[model samples]
Every structure is written in C-alpha cells, then in structure tokens.
Target: MATTTKDRLIEATAELFRHQGYSATGVKEIVDAARAPFGSMYHFFPGGKEELGAATIRWSGAMYGELIEIFYADTSDPVAATRQFFEAAADTVRDTDYTDACPIATVALEVASTSDPLRRATADVFESWLVQLDAHFARNGLTKTQARSLSVSLFCLLEGAFLLARATREHRHIRAAGRTAAAAVRDALEHRASTVARRR
Candidate 1:
C-alpha cells in the first residue's frame, strides 16, 4: 500500500522526536526525513508544529500500545507477558544502538511544562496504555484498582529503565527492571488468588 504524505510526515516527526526531542526537531527535518513536500505539513496541520507534534504523540502512542497488546495476546500468564515485553524492549534498544525506546517520552518531557496541548496529548497516550495494561491484569485475576496501580508502576519502571539503559549503554538495567516488574505482577496475582481462597 502506498503511504500518504500526511502519514509520512507524522512518522518522520515521530522518529525525530524519539531520537532528539520536540524542541530540537524542525519541520524541515521532518519533511526531509519523510520525503514529503515542505508545504504538506501546514496543509495537513494548520496549527503548524504544535499540531503536528500532538498528532505524532497520539499516533506513536497508539502504535506502541497496540504492540503491547500483540505481545501479550498469546501469553495467558500476565507475569510471563510482562517479562517478555520488557525483554523484547531491551533487545530492541540494544539492537538499535539505544536509539529507540518509548517514542513519546522525549517529547513528553520536553513539552510537559511548555505546551498545554502537547502535554495533554502525552497524558492521553499514557492513559490509553494504562487502560490496556489494566485490562490485561484484571483479566488475569487482579482487582481493578490493583491492576491500574501495577500498570502505572510497570510503566514507570520501563520508562526509567529505558533512560538508565541508554545512559549506561548496558542491558542490565532493562533486565533488572523487567525482573522487578514481573515480580510485582506475580505477587499481585498470587495475592489475589490467596484472598479469594481465604474467603471461600
């Protein structure tokens, strides 16, 4: 299928944002990377860079969340699924020379205080991820609140691990963080099971 110009622009902006950040990536760079016409950016996004940035955030976020769903879909055990997801992420970082991680993290941090629209875009993306993770945990025997809290914790672990791993150029941080997240999920599932048994 032929990719549309707008899609290419969004993808290019996302890639730039992943490697650099919102402030560092220019419209020209995006168009060049995307092989898109210069004026197409404004034509598709009248609000200019800010609008494009927000759209890129949402687009990248959805793509990442869908990836999580695909990774977890085949594995019924939530703990195993969690470990697999983190391990895969670590491998990807190492393979890509640490150039790839969460596509929105860089932009999210850069725009958190400076731009309201971008901040909201990041928040919405994070919330969507949390919702997906929460659903997976709940399906695996966790209470709604427990699932949501664990999802948040796991996300924090992954994001922080990505930063640490990239800085050190080592995979140990990713492995360690994955272990901790997997342990947390395991404990939650066990605790829920025990509680149910105790009530019976």
Candidate 2:
C-alpha cells in the first residue's frame, strides 16, 4: 500500500526528532525527508510546527504501542513477552550502533523545559504506553494496582536504561534492565496469584 504524505511527514519528523531533538529539527528538513511539498505541511496542520510535532509524537507512540502488542500477542506469558521485547530493543540498539532507541524520549526531555505543547505531547505518549502495558499485565493475571505500578517501573527501567546505554554505547544497561523488569513482572504476577488463592 502506498503511504500518505502526512504519514511520511510524521515519520520523517519523528526520525529527525529522535536523532536531534525538537529544537534541531526544522520544517524544511522534515518536508525534504518526507518528500512532501512545503504547502502540504501547512495544509495538513493548520497550527503549523507545534501541531505537526504533537501529531507526530502521538503517531509514533501509537505505532510503538502496536509493537508492544505484537510482542505480547506472540506469547501468553507476559514475563516472557517483556523479556523478548527488551531483548529485541537492546539488540536493535546494538545493531544500529546505539543510534536508535525510543523515538520520543530525547525530544521529550528537550521540549519539556521549552515548549508546553510539545512537552504535553510527549507526556501523552508516555502515558499511553503505560496504560497499554498496565492493561496487558492486568489481562494476564495481575491486580489493577499491581499492574499499574509494575508498568510504571518497567517503563522507567526501559527509559532510564536507554539513556545509560546511549551514554555508554553499550547494551549492558538495557539487557540488565530487561532481566530486572522481567523478574519484577514475574514476582508481581506470583504475588497476585497467591493473594487470590488465599482469598479463595
């Protein structure tokens, strides 16, 4: 299927943002990378750069969330899924020479201090990811509270690990984070099972 111009714009901007952050990525670069006309950018996004940036963040978040869903669907065990997801993430970074990680984190940190619109956009993306992870845990046999907390921890571990891995140009941090996150998920699930059994 042929991709739309707006979709291309979002993807190109996202790639630029992931590499150089919000302040560094410009409309001309995005359009050029997207192979889109300059007028199309304004036509699609009347609110201009901020609007396009926010939309791009949301688009990337949703796309990445689908990847999480794919990993979860591939295995019934959420712990295994978690491990697999992180392993793939770490491998990708190593394969890409540590240039690729989360699409939103770099821009999130950079825009958090400068643009309210962009910061909110990034926050919305993170929150959406957290919600999806929490729901996956809950469906696989975790209490709501347990799922939410564990989701937060797992995401924080991943995000923090990315920073460390990028800084060190090593996959050790992310691999360790994956192991730790999987263990935590396992422990949480076991605790929930035990509590439910005692209640029964």
User: Can you tell me which runs of candidate 2 are displaced by over 4 Å?
Assistant: none
- TM per candidate comes to 0.98, 0.94
Model 2 per-residue lDDT tens digits across residues 67-110: 88898865779989889889999999999888789999998988
- Candidate 2 Cα deviation (angstroms), residue 105: 0.6
TM-score of 2: 0.94
For model 1, residues 9-123, the per-residue Cα lDDT tens digits are 9999999999999999988999999998889899999999999999999999999999999877767898888999999999999999998988999888989999999999999
lDDT leader: 1
Clash pairs (backbone) in predicted model 2: none
**Poorest 10 consecutive residues by lDDT, candidate 1:** 71-80
Query: Over all chains combined, what TM-score does candidate 1 have?
Result: 0.98
lDDT (0-100) at residue 104 of candidate 2?
91
Cα-based lDDT at residue 124, candidate 1: 99
CA shift of 199, model 2, Å: 2.0
